[model samples]
Target: MFAKLPFRTGTTSSAIWQGFAGSVMLLLGSLGVGWLASSSVLIRTPLFILARTTPAAVICATVLLCLGALLMFRAWLRLSQHLSGWNDDAGPVLRKALILWVAPMMLTLPLFSRDAYAYIGQGRLMQQDLDPYTNGISALNNYFLLGPDTLWTEAPTPYGPLWLWLEHLAVLIPANSPEIALIPFRLASLAGVVLLAIYVPKLAARHGFNPHRALWLAVLNPVTLMNFIASVHNDSLMMGLVVAGLYYASTKRAVVGILFVTASIAIKPITLIALPFVGLLWAGSRAGWVRKFALWAATLGISMAVMGAMGAVNGLGFGWLAALQTPGTIWHWYAPVGIGSVSLGSLVDWLGGDGTPIADGIQKVAQVISILIVMALAFVKIRLGPSGGLGADLPEPQRYSHAVMRRMAWAFTAVVLLAPMIQPWYVVWLLAFFATTGIKDGWPLRTVFYLSAFFILIALTDQLSVFPWISMEVVRSIAVVVAVMGLLYLTLWDKKTSELFKRNKPDQHAFAVKS
Candidate 1:
């Protein structure tokens, strides 16, 4: 039945170019609708002026951006179908696709986020020798006029010392111009993208998964390109280093791997989750509890030493620990914590009482539950053997590696889902780890594909800086309609893509290919 359907018969190069063209469209559209600051030099550019002045231009750009996003999504879906057939050329094919798709994004202004502007402000704070972990960007002159969200004005930076240092350097290079500072920030993110390109496939290969499929899901997905490249989030570098570290650790280079993971923690403390698994990898699969405990302590000590050194360089001294709770302040309607708190808070409000405390209590409870789940996943043993021992079907090392990667993936998944604010990019953290274990071509793969599409749509609609003269409702409605139609076409109208949703047998060819 599957063979009877007309799958899109084209070279991977075709899909590559299709996505590249879409990125070009996205770049052009971003000029008008991206998160541009009021003081942006682009505001004086003719394209910006034209898009802002004419309602038709704004609508058209919005449509183009939506269309471009859908086109890229479709191209990604098409490329996924060919994963089984890819051989040694998979690396080159994916690299080509990445380069082409990222080119336009590099040229465009920041899309779907103004966080880059915040990085500039934070960097400016560092430039003046101010402690970014303690002083919000609001301390700078004209900070409010910058493109960052006002929420950050009084919020100390949540980023770690290495990232703050990089931010300082990025701003220094541009002579404190926020607009020009974007270049260095984007480049820093691009470097992370490069790290991902290099390491994700290698890790997949080490885990006995299809490197081609893993690369497709982890590196070329719309989520990675849009957030890591377009929005320039520091999480890109963080995830990249984590992937690289895990890869090295799995291959018996524990010290090198720990250093890489430490660097990742310096970028964002979230990857600290990867350290315990690193200790497991270091202790070897057959080690006793004593060895495991020692390795775990060693791993923690190594990470702390690296972190302490980073802190000493700037005298930042762990102030970021206090600011780590800052992201929890945002409440997204889609998050589990957010939903639970809001629902409970509304019930309390209906009873004629203050609900803020109830909401806070709910968040705290959810956080505790998530932490418990993570701990269970980390420590619990999987009894794969008939007599309650490790499975004998696979080698001990293979079993151990698989167990560690699975736990790491689910641990991160638990954190992201239960967090107070679930950003679209946060999903990238788990996706990278999951790819190493392999996304089987069934509901698991389909779920990831659809989720990526959903997040892309959310990102596209969520950040449009609507012109005051135009009706925000009208513009948003158009974007939603266009984006939904495109998604429907991919889901039902396109013959090749529609086939993706079908419950077909797994492709053996995918795993048969040597990494």
Candidate 2:
């Protein structure tokens, strides 16, 4: 099946196959190094027990995982280089790659995150007729013994009703057993991946971008595979819906597009940022404030109706609105606001004052600032003279659609960067739109490529379950050394991949879409 897909002129069948092999390795290694919570049923399996009990097995598996991640990253870079322009075959090539890479991941225990387990626990809560918004997973018997993170024990679910309803159904299918429930959960996540594969190319082609490059950047990237496939995050489904919705809107089916975006919001409310852009898409390029305002009202009204209907099911209502505050509790250092909050709070503590309130205040202010920035980007038009910047050369008809997508991408980027916490996978929200709008070669393309590689490494090393007896520093050092070795080989030793680091004249028509 992999070989059947047409490859671009310069890309080799052998090179792409390396990524498929790497994914298989990743799955094998994950049996030892992946998240194996104490309550997980898999812990009783012989392979898992042997790997966890023996330090040597753990070390070997970690090395294997890191090596696999490096191989996949290198392959993706090589693939990116050959994507010079639009190829009708790009979609098939990327779709095949997606399947080959994602197949092995489906067999692994949840990698990089225990969120899938939390989904199962939340699903069980639904099975018991509990309102996940008001009650935490802790309401279940022996909830602490389950595989979900302790944070979810008391933290109400932040997911929307559609997601909760799906979770409820998933758990019920397995009689509330977390182990069996994971199968359905993963299958549900895979459905999202399928949506992405189908829509990303269509969206790219609709906007005159290279469908192949867009699909590669958004779908085949390692960060996307690990998060959406291995980690089983609901964000996958949310993003797929966003892309599908945007594609429909770009094609002039505004009402249908608005409905799709609303369904996306039902999966995760974060995509609510996209509603205004959908309104703009509906209002058309020459629409005045009155027309745009009316369309925006219509968009919101339709979205509210859809979301309200979903909320009404099983009496879930709109509690997810308030529960939206749940994820704000986490303050990852990667986020700008998170780091600023911590730095400012530390300074206050140095002066012998309570810094908790001050830190919280910073997050709130940053959140508000981010919202303002997104709104400004979405509404305020900046003139770039005759050549309208990124989408300036596009056909007049497509110019509006292109601009809206570009702004939507930036809007998602702002929200992720300025949010109280930024997860590695959150980047996918912006990536889908940016890829479709067109990422010009040179720094624009290189930046996205490098970031994808960096995130793959982060995902590889960040989530391993270290045993109590093992020195965490030692394990981290080993993983870093192995991963660095792999990087060295790709950047310095491999002929094809080495070209990525060399400075070259920028391609003037890199972003040009074939009409």
- Judged by lDDT, which candidate is best? 1
Q: Which candidate is the best by TM-score?
A: 1
Q: What's the lDDT for candidate 1?
A: 0.82
User: In model 2, how large is the Cα lDDT of residue 338?
Assistant: 94
The residue ranges of model 2 lying beyond 4 angstroms of the native Cα positions read 1-11, 83-86, 175-177, 382-394, 512-515
lDDT of 2 by residue, 1-515 (tens): 11122346556465578889888888888887777656766788797889876888888888888888888887788676665444565555666777888899898878888898788789879988898999998899987666788866799998988888888777677443465677877887798888888898777666666666777888888888888988888988888888889888888899889988988899889889999999888888878889988998999999998888888776888888998888889788767899899889999999999898999999998889889988998788633346646566666557778778888889888888888788888887778778888877777877876777667767876778777786667777888888877777776788888777666767743443433
Q: Please write out the lDDT profile of model 1 over residues 1-515, one tens digit for every residue.
A: 01122233456778999999999998888877887766677787797899876888889889989998889998898887754465655667778888999999988778888898899889889989888888888899888667887877889998988898888887777443456778877888898889988888777666566676688888899888999988888988888888889988888899999999999988888888889889888888777789888998999999899898888888888787888888888798888789889888989899999888999988888888878887787666543344333333446676677678888899899888888899988998888888887777778888898889889889878888777998889889999999988898898879888888777776643342422
Q: How high is the CA lDDT of each candidate model?
A: 0.82, 0.80
- Model 1 vs. true fold: TM: 0.94
Error of 2 at 170 (Å): 1.5
